[model samples]
Target: MKESDPNKKEPIGKLISYIHRTQLKRMSRSLGEYGIGGGGQYSFLKAILMSPGTTQDQLTVGLKFDKATTARSVKQLEAAGYIERRADPEDRRSHQLYPTHKAIEFQPVLQTLLDESNAKLTRDLTDEEEDQLIALLQKLNLED
Candidate 1:
């Protein structure tokens, strides 16, 4: 066991870490049930949909993924016909990401999965508690 340092600790780490781990597992299972397998693909899909021509590098940096993994995952999605890489009118060297019709077809399914996940997570919490939890997560993000 590692020695404990009395001076060191985040007051909220235990609850925060539990929430994070549980969220990831639930997200994975939700995506798995939807045939998306939850991964960088989910991030990529969301990023591209929000800013329809985002570059691979933008995804790598924005999503905090390694460049190679981002590239490979994009390639996989491309092969699966979920997304397309188009020449960026702004930059000849970088291609932009766009969702294909195939991906759009899956949007409703994905949304249902998200709705279920959200309902499960909030089933026992009041509206105020949900808001407080979100505020706490937002505070944590500001720390980063």
Candidate 2:
């Protein structure tokens, strides 16, 4: 009898990491066309799209990223013309980030890529299984 691959029994972390790496690679290619690189900037842009005029501090907290990391991503996005930062009238020391027209125009394309990738990943699963998987993943991400 042939031996089964031990990797088949690898922990969920390995599988999740693999998926994240593959998605980042795909995003690097797909988003490069739009002048966005991998480095987690996709999520940052999406967050700004969802809430225009969000503060840098808000982004740091919302994304669970360090302040410096958020600052760097914000700077890159701003320089790339995907986002514009304006002084927050409410908070003189902080700035609010907003997606520019260029970034807004790429929303559908990004959404399509996201949807297609998700469908491809869950293609073999039934609706119930998909829902259960989503629920389980969400549970895992929840703060204890």
Candidate 3:
């Protein structure tokens, strides 16, 4: 195959990958200002959003995290007032993980931050271009 000419078009994939990762890290740093950072807290918040009463073992499966790490993360999140664990009446040793009032209140801010980040990333694209990009990505998914 002939090598692609950089003069014709820049390497969009590589640029997007680098910028996306960097911007994600930077955007997530804002979470620290609200007393949340690192240690699987982001994953924990996302999991609780999807599964309000999920158990730690369930989190292990759903989030693809290891046992010890899952336990440690839950402990930290619980202590931070981001989540609450309720004792299972049926299962003596099992506890269900749910979002705290504080976390529930913060959901809109999370969504706004995500929307702002997405907007920043795609700020240069027109509506038609955004549609085309999404379609192309979906087509690539089919190839995989």
- Candidates in order, TM-scores: namely 0.75, 0.87, 0.67
Top candidate, metric lDDT: 2
**lDDT tens per residue, model 1, 78-134:** 877778999988889889999888788877776676688778878999999999988
Once superposed on the true structure, which residue ranges of model 1 sit more than 4 Å away at CA?
A: 1-18, 33-35, 141-144
| Model 2: lDDT of residue 125 | 98
Highest-scoring model, TM-score: 2
User: Alpha carbon lDDT of residue 43, candidate 3?
Assistant: 72
Q: Residue 97 deviation, candidate 1, in Å?
A: 0.2
Best first by TM-score, ranked: 2, 1, 3
Candidates 1 and 3, the one with greater lDDT? 3
lDDT of 2 by residue, 100-143 (tens): 99889988987888788778788899999999988999889645
- Candidate 3 residue lDDT tens string, 4-116: 68678756676667775667585668677876666546777878976899999999888777899899888877887889999977797999999998989988887687678
User: Candidate 2: where are CA atoms >4 Å away?
Assistant: 1-8, 141-144
lDDT of each: 0.77, 0.86, 0.79
Q: Which ten residues in a row have the lowest lDDT in candidate 3?
A: 135-144
lDDT of 1 at 100: 87
lDDT of 1 at 68: 86
